[model samples]
Target: MNYQLSLTVAICFGLLVLLGYFLPDFDLLILLRAEILRWAAILSGVAMFVGIISLLKVHFNKFMDQKSNWGYSLVLVLTFLITFGAGVFSFIFPQAEGLVDFMFRYVQVPVESTLAALLAVLLLVAGMRMVRYRRDWTTWLFLAISLIMLIGLVTIEAPIPDVFPFLRDWLLTVPVVAGARGILIGLALGAIITGLRIFTGADQPYGE
Candidate 1:
């Protein structure tokens, strides 16, 4: 009974949202869709809050138990508490908003940048390993392009190849844009399929 009720509501809401998109002149469908979307956003916020509480609970317990790799758990707990505290404090007193900004600028941004650097290094290492094992033209091409991009970052007096900057720009503007568009097309198709499946009751991800 509960599953049927949930399925009916989901399908109806999905149809309404679709209708609102297709029939922009209909104020009734537009209003209902807007309200539905707002409620969905509220529910999403609640879900995120629940996830944060669960994450903290698990990490705090691990830290207290002093389990293997507990140091990472400790860092996560302390960082979360400090960030959350600052956010709450700023919410109460807008003048102290700089506390939150400092946490992001000094801590969060650096951490993210460090992770990005490490990811680039890892990708280069992986490319090198692939070259050793495969010895393919594609692998060599990838390595060559990567090298070009890295060299473009250096503070050299002039481009070594004289066309290094142009080549790098062409690579970024052409291949990267094409690849990104392909990915977006795939995502749009997948979203449409997901919506269709939900409308047809082909997928009941809500429950069994």
Candidate 2:
């Protein structure tokens, strides 16, 4: 009974959203869509809060169980608490916004950038190993493109005029852009089909 009610609501809301998007000139639908989106935003915030509580519970359990790598779980909990406390403090006292900004700019950004740099190095190493072992045209082509992009970066920054910058721009503008558009179109079609399936009761991700 509950599953049927939920499925009915899902189909109704999904169709309403699709109608709102495709029929922008309908005044009533536009208003309904706005209200639905506002409710969605509130629900999304509540979901995030629930997710945080779930995360904390899992980590706390791990820390208490003395399992392998439990020390890392403890560290995670401590970091989460500190960050949450800082955010609360900023909310209560507006003067602490600078501290929050500093933490985001220095701590968060650097950590993210460091991870990205490590990933790039790992990919480069993997590409080199693949080319060495595979001896395939595809592998060689991939490696060659990677090398060209790297060289383009270096040349663009150098103190000499070169065609690398133009070549990089052309590659990005033509092949990259075209490929990205194709991927996006495919994804949009897939999402539409999935939504249609759910709406028609052909797919019930929640339950039977």
Candidate 3:
């Protein structure tokens, strides 16, 4: 009974949202849809806050238990609290704007850039290993594509009418776009199927 009620509510809201999008001339439907969306956003924010609390509780428990590598959890909690406090202070104080900018520019950006550089180096190493050990046509093709893309990106400042730029543009516009669109279509179809399963009670994600 409870499951049926939940499924009915989900299906009704889903259909209403779809109808609102397709038949925009209905003022009442549009107004109701807007109200539903507003509530959805509020609920999403609440869910996020709940998730953060749950995460902090789990980590705090681990720290209290003195589990192996619990120091990392302690550090995570400290950093999370510090960042949150900093954000709140910055919001409340006009003078703290500089502190926010300094944290983002000096601390966050450099950390992110370092991680990205490390990832690029790891990818290159993996590609080299694949070429050296596998020696298969597919491995060679993957390595070739990676090298071409890297070269194209690095040589972007080369004079116009250059081969690297031309190849880069072609690869980006054709193969990359086609692959991305195919992945997006697959994801959309999967979501639709999952939604249908829930609507029909074929998949009872909520519980038995």
Q: List TM-score per model, in order.
A: 0.79, 0.81, 0.76
Q: Which of the predicted structures, 2 or 3, would earn the higher TM-score when compared with the native?
A: 2
lDDT of 3 by residue, 102-185 (tens): 888998899999998899789878877877789878887776777677777883365544676678889999999999999999
- Show the lowest summed lDDT stretch of 10 residues, model 2: 155-164
lDDT of 2 by residue, 1-208 (tens): 9889989999888888889999999999999999999999999999999999999999999999998999999998998988888999999999888877888899999999999889978987887788779997888777777767777778335663467667777888999899999999999999989878999988889974
Root-mean-square deviation of Cα positions for candidate 2 versus the true structure, in angstroms: 3.1
Q: Which pairs of residues collide in candidate 3?
A: none
Give candidate 3 regions above 4 Å deviation: 87-106, 129-135, 151-170
After superposing all C-alphas onto the true structure, candidate 3 shows an RMSD in angstroms of 3.7
Q: Give the TM-score of candidate 1.
A: 0.79
As a TM-score, model 2 comes out at: 0.81
As for model 1, its CA RMSD to the true structure in angstroms is 3.2
- Residue-level error in angstroms, candidate 2, position 149: 4.0
Model 2 has an lDDT value of 0.87
Name the top lDDT candidate.
1
